[model samples]
Target: MSSARTTPGASHHEDAVGTAADGSGLLTYASLVDGKNVPSDQWVYVVDSDALLQDAFSSLTLKRKLESGRLSPEELPGGSIVGRVARADRETVLQAVEAASRATVEWNAFPLDERLDRFGALLHRRLTEQADRTIEILLREGHPLALARWQVSGALECFSPESLAFYRSQMLHESRHGERRISVRRRPDGVVCLNPPQNAPLSSALLGVTSLMAGNSLVVRAPRSAPLGVMYVLHEIVAPVLEELGAPGGTLNVVCGDPAPMLSAWLDSPLVDDIMYFGSSEAGIRFQERCVAAGKKPILELAGNDTVVVWKDADLEYAAEALTESFYGSGQLCMIPNQVLVHPDVVDRLTALLAEKAADVRGGSVRQEDVLLTPVLRNEKFFACLEDALSSGAELVCGGHAIQDDGTRDTAGIFLEPTVVLVRGLEGARKVQAVRHETFFPLLPVIAAEPAPDAVLLDRFVDFVNSNPYGLRNSVWAGDPEVVEHFVTRITQGGLLKVNDSHIGFLPGLPTHGGTGLTGGVYGEANYPVLRTSHIQGVSISDGGIRPREAVFGAWQAMRGEDGTAAAGA
Candidate 1:
């Protein structure tokens, strides 16, 4: 499954296209519109970041693009020219929406059970079979093998039997009310438009398929920076499943191009009911307002400044390992831990363990199975946050330098070393930018509060966690059940809470994404794509043909027992 290759240090190319490991031509993808691979005059060339870092390409056009600030190697994943894709225009975007609107008529009418068996079951099976290819594409796009595996696994878990069953129950259920049938059901929200994030686009796009289980037709905008993996998922994996189920053409449409124009088109389209958007909180909140103004539902997957609390009695080794997860993909992902709140008593020991662990998290080529670091082209923000933390009385515990692919320090290095800083007092924690916001780099802030009684300390921690404006996932590491219970019941923020568990790991029955506050915008909550992309309605039916007046005044009628005469009991 690995597409590992060796290339010369310098090579010339007319365009961004390279041979595969077996010497076959690189894959080319087209925008999927109305169930067809639609081509365009324009193209977005995808370069493998790893290849760029290795100096595999020295084309004059590439150099000029870089010199002119048009291309950033940090944005790409692997070293060679991975693939190229067509760029969509306004007409293509409109066509996609129309196709989705037309398909929903047939799609939304299918029985939930049938939809699950055909789409859900079949998707899981196909992804499992093609898991290797999926991971390979992800790796080529810059995700480390381990992170890629986790993404693939998380996507598969969403379609697991247990997950499907839970969704089934939520979509519709019935109950008997003596002579009547009372029911509650979820209806598709018509055509849905999804804009997956540049980071981890493929897996995010795959997970978006859950909306279809709720009977909604979809139009996905593959991120222009990383579209191949997403294009493959939709055009290859999902399209085939929809076809096998005899789904209508346009049941699923995909396009790749600029976001602003496509988003404007979606906002203007009457056919688009819900837009599943992923981005920073500032941008997402603004977009949410726009979506509402346009009379469309905004399903946001925004920024996360997740916190990990380590109680004094926690397994320090295990907790340290979990905290290290923040460095995965250089902490570019939203769900990874952003800050650590450790008990004053255990703060020193935990920081020591973290420092030791951080030393082993090396930055290198993305093709290496063990490497997690990717290029950080815009590291100025990372350094700014670090400076803010240092100025706010925080001490750098380990790593505050840029590391090269060869594990050496250089100011011009493309990777930010896994850095940790310790802030002494919780009261002043947020004064540090790294503590207050999502740095999106491999910098972790460990804060310890002034010593206090267990109950008082627990209360303060809960208050601090709730005060966060962003709410994605919050986690606690504690051995005491009572302490865990206190944190769980008192903490009033975040979408998911983990106690003595992996902070960013996924489970079949749990939501892989979502949050409250800024993380999800005005209506944000733990997102289940199936539920988020649908609406609910209550229903009641009676074959007894009860009179409308009698039904409306049933309680009074029962008391009178008919003919204006009370029953024997009455």
Candidate 2:
């Protein structure tokens, strides 16, 4: 391990720091294979998300380096650098797979209770203890503070007592019968490989830890662009817990590299039994086909075009607040509301409130506590979506421009304004691409259905929401029990359904992630990684006195009378 030094103004927990040749601080990380920090000859740097916004000199120097070919665009992600991560090669990926395959033997043998204690209970406690440091690393890696905190909170919720208990029940259950014992249990799927998405890699990686509770060894590919936080959680937090539990050295392997080779390696490797993939739905569906062809279970967490329906009876203020969640992380997150179906009666009021709230969501340096807008590296899609909606006869409610890091409007700005468009009628809304597809940007479309009887409108709203191609989450807001019930029981979409609550907030016993349809491929649903990475087996043990003939015919024989004849009813 390289020695770490604390730079001036840095927190004490910032131990990933190393001094550069000029004596300035640089955050450093390495890939972990077989419980070792494997450094590489090639390195890639991740710029602080706020570096360009906050430091003119650093920004100018980065620009000069880029122009001079001293720093290639591929080497510096997000435009400038605060940290350098080892870039793993094909060999490192193979090493990780080999280590994970070897460790799975012992890991799968450990009792489920012990695995949960180490991976669920103890890991949760350590994450809480290091919460601040974790959040700091997330911030440095470019996550807005609020989104980062929510990610950590959601990840921790997976290991809560309630969640762990639920997992335990799902994993195993035993029952007693006269002279017989019946056990239903889930067996580890052996080596499970995780390909976490780059947008929220650390939390996604942390969530992947639940596979450990199922006694499956892990090979996680940290996003090369944002590898530090993911590496910190795995090596700094998760590894220690595994060590204390006496897990094999190779139980958890992490590598940072180009995703194509790593994914191909996993798909082709015989030792890999399950692959937890996260990406766009189009690509994920194709990957799912590949995984199936390779005889590996594919657990996909894909794109979400989630919907939020607001009835006229809803508390407009609260519903509006929930709608504002669509703009969280500038709407880059998969779980946020992508489009809304509002009762025409309440559409105007709700949209007004949403625009008012969205205006408060400002773009600035990630270091700012109040900032939620991060740099939208490629906003061409955002513009294209916005234009498609408008051209399809949708009216712009508010926000259709780009904002600079300083929160000023400029075409060249890196941050997109929180945009909301009003699409009239269900049919017309479908014509808008932003409403039908995952915009993956701060572009929300509020569709106001044509006015009709309450029953007719309610049915339309439910049907519209259910017809959505992508389904990660769906939320409804209504004060009436009937309306809420109608939505709850009738809407057959999404992995989770929220009612009159924060759309993206985490709750115990509820899935922090996962979805149906495009959001999750054919095998996708509310994903509990522990359960996803394991398979169930039914076990029945009989007493020595029981004969095989008796076991097979006893139940049927009981229906017969004592005279060796069938009973009256039989």
Candidate 3:
């Protein structure tokens, strides 16, 4: 909880939130687990001569710190542990940053493959060496083991050979017409602000590292809710790799606490080129708007209310497994299926199987195989929202009960049984609802449609999922080759779509990240993680090159030129 600080700059009073920090300045919140050692988050504003000047200085200081490795250390509330970084004085950050700018140039020029290999090695080592401890921190931090596994394992896979394969697939190109050979490089912006969710720590670091390996500097502004967990993963596992790999010091900077101001600062600063964020769509959208206003590229893995379309041809048991994964993290992920599109023919059968499976899923304390991350249920807020939707006519099929089990009803012990709500057709109060928009909490609403082999239902479902305001992930549980094909063709066009598979099964190097349009600026699966980080520069040395189409006219545009050769465009 200690750091050197000089004269601080602009500051502003914090806005009121639910929880408050203790006298020791420790952050305290009503987390999924109460009485835990997790710190309460603190918010501060950079003070300046004027409000606009504060923003201007905040942006300036953010850039200097990002360029230099001299990050302001964040301390947890109570001063027992460090939670978020403190903002250093403007002069101090600027002076420290001056040294790091040189490293970015060198890091960027090194061959991409060589740098990727270095990170790939880091992933390998982190997996083998830090496996046990990594798992422990994630569990203690509130993520269920099942969810933690994805976070840790996803990092390993992100820089693995598979990811390399995906990058290869994306980076190469074949010429279509006349000597215009091309390749698309997923360039890294100078520095990226990756704000990961509390539910995922390792996955967030992997997101930043994958982009860094793609040749960009990075600054991770982790969520204040569980910043320490992510900080551990980054500082312990990823940062060591960057050091060993000869990457610039600021290749990836880590910070926790309120991200709004840092995000605003980064967006407004020239040193930071991109912002990678993960959270509710509303928050992500706000970040995107600010980034756009600042002319920064944003890669938002925003909210999702994904739907799994199950056809009568599908194996009910397999579809059930997929359903389990969709809600594995208590349906907090953007990829988790928020609803099910069950054909009427198999509704009764699949419904029965799902109910049985749901009943059997182990509950209570988070265990190794624990698939569910019991949400910090909103209680009265949850029920009130449910009632509003139900009274508006959405059917409550089963299990909306709060934990009536005396064994598990504490202030911080938030748990909700897997929910199953049924909505008829596409509209009514159920249609175009929040349930239809994004995955939040562990609620699954099934939209049952008339039985038919026609792919029309799935097509309509795809449109509904993709056309909605936000885009991240969508999936299908059908075995029909035709359905699978359609799902692959249509869904992959978005972020990471799966077929007869779990919605959250993301492999390294695969474009299993980033989304389109409403989600954020041009980024997805973080697929653009590497591609978007670097800018494109075309180079050609033709062994035998240059051939242009001679127009119908004898002289043509080329001959008309003074040099008897047309400009490339001409």
Best by TM-score: 2
Which candidate achieves the best lDDT against the true structure?
1
As a TM-score, model 2 comes out at: 0.93
lDDT score of residue 8 within candidate 3? 17
Clashes of each: 9, 1, 42
Q: Worst ten-residue run, lDDT, model 1? A: 1-10
lDDT accuracy of residue 344 in candidate 3: 74
Tens-digit per-residue lDDT, 1-570, candidate 2: 334322111223345544233333566656778877787766666666667566646765774574355865455544356766667899989999999999998988888878985568888898899888888888878888888888888978878888888888899899987888999999899999999998999989988889988999999998876788887788778887888788887889888888888899999999899999999999999999999999999999999998998888899999998888888888888999988888889888998999999999987866677888877767888998889989899999999999887668999888889999999898667878998798889999999999899988878888888888888899999999977898899998889999999999998878878888898999878989988898989998986888898779887777996678998989
**Could you arrange the candidates by lDDT from highest to lowest?**
1, 2, 3
Cα displacement (Å) at residue 424, model 1: 0.8
Per-candidate TM equals 0.92, 0.93, 0.75
Query: Model 3: residues >4 Å from true position, as ranges?
Result: 1-100, 168-187, 367-371, 375-377, 404-413, 427-434, 451-459, 490-493, 521-526, 542-570
* Model 3 agreement with the true structure over 1-570: per-residue lDDT tens digits: 221111111111132111123332322222111101122222322211122122334443543453244433232112222223333332322222332344567777878666776566666777668776676656645566776777767766766777666665664443443444555455545655577766664576666666666666666655655554555565556656666666666555555545566555566566666777776666777777777888878777766656677876888898887787655665666667677777777877887777767654444444447445454445555565566557656677655655522224344445556666666666452453546566476667777775555767777666666655555666677777887787677764356676776667766555556766555444544355777566665444444555434423435754567566675665
Q: Give the CA lDDT, 0 to 100, for residue 433 in model 3.
A: 54
Error of 1 at 204 (Å): 1.1
Clashes of 2: 1
